[model samples]
Target: MRKRIGLLLGCLIIISIFTSISVSAMTAEEIIKKRDSNEYIKTAKAESEMTIVSGNRRITKTMVSYIEGDNGLTIFTNPRDRGTKFLKRDDDLWMFFPEAEDLVKISGHMLNQGMMGSDFSYQDMMESDKLTELYKFELIGEEKIEGRNCYVLEGIAIEGKKVSYYRRKSWVDKERFVGLKEELYAQSGRLLKAMKVNKVEEIEGRWYPMESVMEDKLRKGSRTEFVIKSIEFNPKIPAGTFTLENLK
Candidate 1:
């Protein structure tokens, strides 16, 4: 009987180990929760240097942007550019163009257009929610990406969704749910662009993507790079931080 008891315990140990491995192989969405209820959401702030190139020429624009959670975003460029330059909330759409001096509401149909003629759309440039909220994630498998063992997850937008990426392929670190690189595909099944998050900085003991480069797979020789020079978290933002009246 004692020998049988030992054999039973051994079997249980092996089962536990197998269970652990199975959970480890789960998709990134299984690991992280949406930031909406999370108390510790990181905010991004800093000077932005954007370099745009269509062909042989390049245009550089310097701006400042602030992101509060998944909704509050303020992008300021060109001191003389009018409008609040602040987008505080996002429901079904978003608005504002600093240079245009007027606010234009985005239509659900226009969400597919290239933002500023670059690879990323206006929606792509904005803050994003956790994977589980916006995507139905699945671990397709693993592969070596840039010498890193990454879990390749495929995300499909939920049916009847208003605004979303049709299909996305993300390579996430086994240890970190945040993706190191991502590819967005259009609703028509065309590869729109490739986004590479090159550098990550540990600020205040939190990891943040410091440098992001996006290439337009559809438009040749066009790219945009986001460089974060400085970051301040949880600053005292005003209640009316982004009122339309300020645009005047």
Candidate 2:
């Protein structure tokens, strides 16, 4: 009887190990796909507020944006930046300056720069691609973030793909499938940026990030907090809304 009990315990341990490996192998892709499905908006209109924090200084700005697939158009409504607009179509980005009456094509290194002096880069703001499309992910481990159980994964940029960050580490809530935190890294393995989601709410039966903070790791004491004031999902958007001519 004693020998039989020992053998049964050993068998249970082996089964547990295999179960863990199976989850690790399958969970990374499944988690990312579920997250993308929940968060990726096909068509939406949003009003948002951004507060740029540099040391003790704070600057606030507001904007309204229309988004469809990979295209978006944002127009600043704040007095200081009134009439400034940004339009993104395909992989191209364009900015219109109301003060200068000029339109600038954003390309090359400019894409890496901050958007409107905020912690978010132009590429960060304009990017609409899914994570699975950009990187190959592996489930590294699990941790708890803000009292919530999270699945931690590390992703390396796929070769032949253009990406802002060469490597990324993400903490996604296991139950909700929402991304709670992410760390972006440079090609040289240096930390470039980090984001933490502060609040989330159920919108249209999907969990949505309503407030978040993004920090530029290279810049000490500088961070930006973004809040979604309002959003309408799958609203009717007019044709040519993302056109360059509309920007002018």
lDDT winner among the candidates? 2
Best by TM-score: 2
Writing each residue's lDDT as its tens digit, candidate 1 over 22-117 gives: 867564566334212231355656666666677787766566666556546556564543233546455433557655656766556576676655
lDDT of 2: 0.92
- Pairs clashing within candidate 1: none
How does candidate 1 fare on TM-score?
A: 0.75
Give TM-scores for every candidate, taking all chains together and pairing residue i with residue i: 0.75, 0.90
lDDT, residue 78, model 2: 92
What would the per-residue lDDT of candidate 2 be over residues 1-248, giving only the tens digit for each residue?
99999999999999999977876766688988887777888999999999999999999999999999999999999999999999988889999998899999999899889999999999897665588888999989999999998999999999999888999999888878889999999999999999999998889898888999999999999999999999999999999899988998
